[model samples]
Target chain A: MTKTTSDITKRTSIGAQRNPASEEAILTAAGALLSEGGLAAFSIEAVARRAKAGKPTIYRWWPSKAALLLDVYHRQKGETFYADTGNTRVDLIAFLESLLGFWKKNGGEVFRSVIAEAQSDPAALEALRDYAVTRCRASGIILERGVTRGEIRADLDIPLVMELFSSFCWQRLLTGRLDASRAQLAHLVDAVLTGFASKESHAQ
Target chain B: MTKTTSDITKRTSIGAQRNPASEEAILTAAGALLSEGGLAAFSIEAVARRAKAGKPTIYRWWPSKAALLLDVYHRQKGETFYADTGNTRVDLIAFLESLLGFWKKNGGEVFRSVIAEAQSDPAALEALRDYAVTRCRASGIILERGVTRGEIRADLDIPLVMELFSSFCWQRLLTGRLDASRAQLAHLVDAVLTGFASKESHAQ
Candidate 1:
């Protein structure tokens, strides 16, 4: 059984009544189905069947297929481990490497599902944008630290920079290219950051 | 009635058999259908019915929906005009502004369909990637000209730069965000080119 986004909100007030274990089971099952079957085979019914939960249980946690998948995507992402080494370039590269690794290993399929769904469904696009917003803010920590340490310009637009960074990753994945080599990733971060650090940008 | 990739190749050898007007009508119908209803409403059947051509007429030229849609995308892009001012900065801003405008008005819907279809189907991905490759090269001209004029770094990686630039556009489109303003586009181009130009990058 899965808990809907709102259900989780409600359950937060009283954790004793709802079993948290079912949420894990449901998400795990959804991930398995996605891994083996792709988006075409994933559905609320299929997830419920695989998890031995009623369809209502899945519905309670997510209102639609995209919703369920979004939860799965976030859950999977929450587990990818990376750290700040107190160096902007070093930290950014490590962060992107972890991200690219995760995408190659897991996030690619899930993101593909979300992006594909977003193409036609406005709701899915909103959810994806919401997710992107969170990740962008989180990733901005690298630049934030960089600015504080004087490794990055104080006036750099963090949001636009992050958008550019993610755009590269998503574009490559959507195009079915291999995960970029560390060298390529290094080039990207260096290029964007260099541009930010330059006097020409500051003059504007 | 639009020509297939192979058909175009064969046509180069034998140029007399094709009717340019029907080809134009089929492509125009496809662009309109994609504009009005997106991928769901775009089909060999719908296109044939709309163009008053037989299904075989479409298949004879396109072979598949992805191919047909690719042609439509290319046709749309071919019509967007932008100048290559001798100044790299000016030319890039103009180019990106044109792209952003195109995506906002028309390319967004069509690109969303192609990107969405590519996510699910390998063949569609190949077609979309082919389009991307061509566009990437074409856009690379800005950087190439910059290098020639001693404005951009001579040793910069063109392919990586193109990936970054396209990533920004596709990312915005996929996330359902408005195109970055021209000032923002200029900022991005300037930032990226600055990064490429900075001596630190060359030291690597």
Candidate 2:
């Protein structure tokens, strides 16, 4: 697992040789298209048209339509962290709160459309799965750190915990009830962390 | 939470009776259409025509397309519990395993279309949300029972726990890699339960 984490880290830098400017332009255009008209409006042709780049340039980088979307998901991951708040409970809550807020403030609309497309399209589902796995792996780092520090249980099921964490966001995202308020987030963290608490000590 | 569960159960039964026969027919047609054509091929007209029922009847029962799809989801829930195996760990695993099996048996087609429809269509998302909330509330009852039986932590975050459980299903549902084999399920349950374990009895 540790090796896998390092490998994922290494792969992140491998794709750096591609023209960053073109990739950025494509992502920006794609984001705009996604926001303006949802998945139906997102097309390679439109992305090229919006980015002022040729279709060949777009196709050269991304293998398919879903690949471009996944690039966006990857880029977003580079910007978010799971445990930066010092306190594990606070960090968990803040991570979720920020994610929910981000969804509502920036990512919600595009995500909704992505989810819709993933439902019906195999390609889009692949993109979403990639995003989910990537995010899970990233969050695993934080949980692993928590485990190492004895803040979280060492024998914890990282994938399941990550899945649980991710699901909360998905539930809120799908429902459009993404509230990042501290109180709500605190409650969520408290509840989840309680699951990690040792039962015997609490019995006393 | 118990009250909420009862309310949903009551609503479901009442809702079931209103158009049980027509609803079942529509769902059958809709499910078939989804299996064959995905979201692109799903439509009220197609369902109505296929079910041999009038469009007006479909509309009368379900206010929107997503609502019709949701009825299909509800109907699927009525089918059977995948595996009980007695142990909570095995039961959860069996449930997830069956879920994955169902998708594979259908060629990973039905849910793919449903997810796609859910992404772009607000109605679809709403239906998903309604179904999710209802389902979560129902699962919460199971958790409550677990708590009562001393199998699960009393302080577990009900909503968060449910989210975690559902997310595993969603990830598998979206990715078509629902690898809930016996070993994988054992690992997952150990990790989750360990993470949720109380501090006094850390030996397990």
Each candidate structure's TM-score, on Cα atoms with residue i matched to residue i, is 0.76, 0.80
lDDT of 1 by residue, A78-182 (tens): 734337687777777787788778889878888887889988898677667776765665566667667776666665666677777777778888898756789
Task: Give the best candidate by DockQ.
Answer: 1
- Candidate 2 chain B has its poorest 10 consecutive residues by lDDT at B8-17
Off by over 4 Å in 1: A1-41, A45-63, A79-81, A196-204, B1-41, B45-63, B79-81, B196-204
Clashing pairs in model 1, backbone N/Cα/C closer than 3 A: A3-A61, A4-A60, A4-A61, A194-B195, A195-B195
Give candidate 2 regions above 4 Å deviation. A4-17, A20-42, A46-53, A73-78, A157-160, A180-188, A196-204, B4-42, B46-53, B77-79, B82-86, B155-160, B196-204
Query: Candidate 1: deviation at residue A185, Å?
Result: 2.3
**Model 1 error, position B73 (Å):** 2.1
Q: On a 0 to 1 DockQ scale, where is model 2?
A: 0.38
Question: What class would a CAPRI assessor give candidate 2's docking?
Answer: acceptable
Compute the lDDT of residue B180 as modeled in candidate 1.
72
